[model samples]
Target: MRGELTAKGRATRQRIIEGAAAVLRERGAALATLDDIMARTGTSKGQLFHYFPAGKDELLVAVAQFEADQVLEDQQPYLGCLDSWEAWQQWRDVVIERYEAQGDECPLGSLFFQIGRSTPGTRAIVIELLRQWQESLAAGVRALQGAGLVPADVDADIRAAALLAAIQGGVSILLSTGRSTHLRAALDQGIADLRGTSHAAV
Candidate 1:
């Protein structure tokens, strides 16, 4: 059922999801239970069911969406703008710092693993997240072109896609081996190569 919740209702719902995400992050999605979430959020079972009629699955999906947003939101104003080399470097630092701080506790990845392939909604959430992230990167690339930092002939979409892949690969390795060296290398080299294009075109 679609919720036409009041302003207060929306806040309460958001609180539940955020609290659930915290529980998942701390306890791991595989082990977290609805009771744990309720305790964390200070919500009763009835209140939880009111917001999530489908119970655990519905709530978990909500948490998944929350985690997806956080993946990008953590980068903040830096990701929103890449008008200069300095800005890009700041963004790269933010990315590395965010992931390193997160360490092996990948909230989104853990959510995906817990849900597995049973729910198509989870897959859709992931796809949308990647699309949005790539689009942001592409916009940054275009900004460089507009400023003549990157040659106009350079393919923004391709560059963004490749950069996104490199970041994802680095993140995977970080999760597996608990290291950020690959991530830093990928970002530094990718940005340097982009900067090189500016020199080559001149």
Candidate 2:
């Protein structure tokens, strides 16, 4: 049941979620418990339950959304304005740096795994995030086309989809192997494919 929360109440609720995410990132979601979030946020059970009455599962979903926001947030400036090859490269590096720093601990992935990927709500969050991501990438490709850097018929959406899929796969491998080789390869291949289309158009 949603309450008409005061400003402070809203802030406290957000704090709880952020604190819980930190706990998840530091110690796997499997191990981080309600008391852990309580201690981390300095909140008592009464307040915690007031916000997340559904308990761990509900809180975990909120944290997943938070992490997903961060994934895009961290790539901003570069990701938001990819009008040229250089801009795209900057965005690519930003993504690489963010994921590299994260190492094998993908907070969003952890949330998905924790809740089971097939859960309708959780799966929708993932799909929506990917949709927005691909749209931005496709827009960047379209920008290149406008600037004569890529062919007019480059099928930006399809290209962006493939590139995004490759990046996700590369990140998976990076997590498994603790190496950046696959990430680099995926970005390189994606860029090269775009460049080829540009040359073909010329």
| Most lDDT-accurate candidate | 1
Residue-pair clashes per prediction, in order, are 0, 0
CA lDDT of each prediction against the hidden true structure: 0.92, 0.89
Which pairs in model 2 have colliding backbones? Answer: none
lDDT score of residue 192 within candidate 2 = 87
TM-score of 1: 0.97
Per-residue CA lDDT of candidate 1, range 49-135, in tens? 999999998888899999999989999899999888999999999999999998987889988888885579999998899999999
Give lDDT tens digits, candidate 2, residues 1-202. 5568888888998999999999999888888988989999999999988998998899999899998888888989977888998998888889898889989878888889989999997999999999989999999998888888898878999999999999999999999999878998999889988898766656
Worst 10 residues of 1 by lDDT: 1-10
TM-score of model number 2: 0.96
Off by over 4 Å in 1: none
- Every model: Cα RMSD to truth: 1.0, 1.3
